[model samples]
Target: MNILVTGATGFVGRRVCARLQKSQSYNLSSAVRQSGSNPPGSEVVIHEVDGQTSWQCALKNQQVVIHTAARAHIMNDEVADPLAEYRRVNVDGTLNLARQAAEAGVRRLIYISSVKVNGEQTPAGCPFTAEDAAAPADPYGVSKLESEMQLRQLAKDTGMEVVIIRPSLVYGPGAKGNFATMVRLVAKGLPLPLGSIRNRRSLLALDNLVDLIVTCISHPNAANQTFLAADGEDLSTTELLRGVANAMGIPSRLIPVPAGLLQFGATLLGQKALARRLLGSLQVDIEHTRKCLNWTPPLTVEQGLRHCFEIRQD
Candidate 1:
């Protein structure tokens, strides 16, 4: 099979390329903005162009096109017109790539979407499922949802298979984002007052997410389906932090601050938005994915945490 991977130079994309390389017997084409940081061991045909034009040529004769590229979340984009930019890249560019892939007779287009597309936080006792109404809270999430809609339309029009994988809070070695920041904060022996929250949120390990993506690539059940993926278990902020501490071989110093007080303080400091998401319940019910794909995440929360700590130790 000939596969094309966009965002092949990114954290998850690099890992996926590496896995594809090791598995062998397939031709790999990687699209990147730059040429120097290609994934090791994969003899990737690197094409330098933006997503709109890049895929026009890079997707030729490809059996599967994994669209992992996107305008990733940025905390500093607080006041910017996030919707416009996000739509341009995440929605428009995604459609362009999908169109090219369909035109090139690509069979499957696996899109790596964010779980945020199913609303920022699922209601208490009402875990999110693939059939849930997609109410994206942020511009980034909205963009992803819009792109998924476009992919569905393209699939209907061209008869190309579209598979969507929504992963929650993915973290592991070399992961850079909010999760990485949390790991660093815990590693520094900082006292965090997150123990009071009793919310459960699902997470994705790099290894588990990679495995799931590979499964989705060829699994007969994954065709024309959207799946939410996680480690199959939920962990509270306290549990996650404690696990991180354990992984780092350090004692957790979690304090039990009142949630109201924390919110009040954050409001006073103009960071309430940040505090709520950090200490909120973002659970997802991935039962459909497991049942349909007949897949289970091999890594537990503890194991994933340990792997992150092990790799981050330098």
Candidate 2:
């Protein structure tokens, strides 16, 4: 099988490439941003395709196009209109790539979208499902939702298979995000004030997310499917922190700070956004993904955490 992967240099893209190489079944073509080298194996091909220009040339005879490229979340983006920046990359760029993939006769296009497309955050007792109406609260989430719409629309005319996978906070080896910062803090023996909070959130282990991607790549039932991916385990902040502490070979050092006080302090420190993210729930329901793919995560949360810590040490 020939696979063209955009964002092949990204964290998830690298892991996806590694997994595909290990399988020894698919030919991997990396759509890179620059004229650079591909992964070590000769099975990998690197081509520059920034979603503009003649990007479709790289997708020749590709069986599947896994798109992981997007303008990810950034803390320091000071554009007068953040939506424009997000649309340029997340929406316009997506449609551009999809059009090119369609023109190139790619069989499938798997879009790695964020769970935020369901909403900026899920509420307590209500994990967002694939059936839920999109109500993205942030510019990034809104852009992703728009892109998904565009993909659906494009599929109607192109006769292409479009699969959308919305993953929650992903963590594991080489994971860098809010979760990574939490792990690093725990590793450093810093006491976290998250223990007091009892917000349940969904997390997708890197391995499990990769498994879902592979499943959707060729699954007959996955065509034009919108799925949510996770580890099938919903964990609270306290449980997550304890797992991190255990993985780091240290005693749990989490303090149960009062939620109100934490919010007050966050507001005073000009970090209300951080406070909301930490204290709020962002769970996703992956029942549809599991039922459709007939898949289950092989790694437990503890196992995933161990892998994360081990990778951080190396």
Best-matching candidate per lDDT:
1
Model 1: lDDT of residue 169:
86
Cα-based lDDT for every prediction: 0.84, 0.83
Candidate 1 lDDT: 0.84
Worst 10 residues of 1 by lDDT: 41-50
Residue 216 of model 1 has an lDDT of 85
Task: For candidate 1, write residues 1-314 as lDDT tens digits.
Answer: 88888888888888888888777766787777665764644334544333455555677678998888888877678646889888888898889888888988999999999998998886555788999989988899999999999899999999999999999989988887788788789878889988787777889999999899998888898999999989988988888888888988999988999888888889999996777676678888999999999999989989988987787765
How many collisions per candidate?
0, 0
Deviation (Å) of 308 in candidate 1: 1.6
TM-score for each model:
0.94, 0.93
- Model 1 misplaced regions, further than 4 Å: 40-51, 78-80
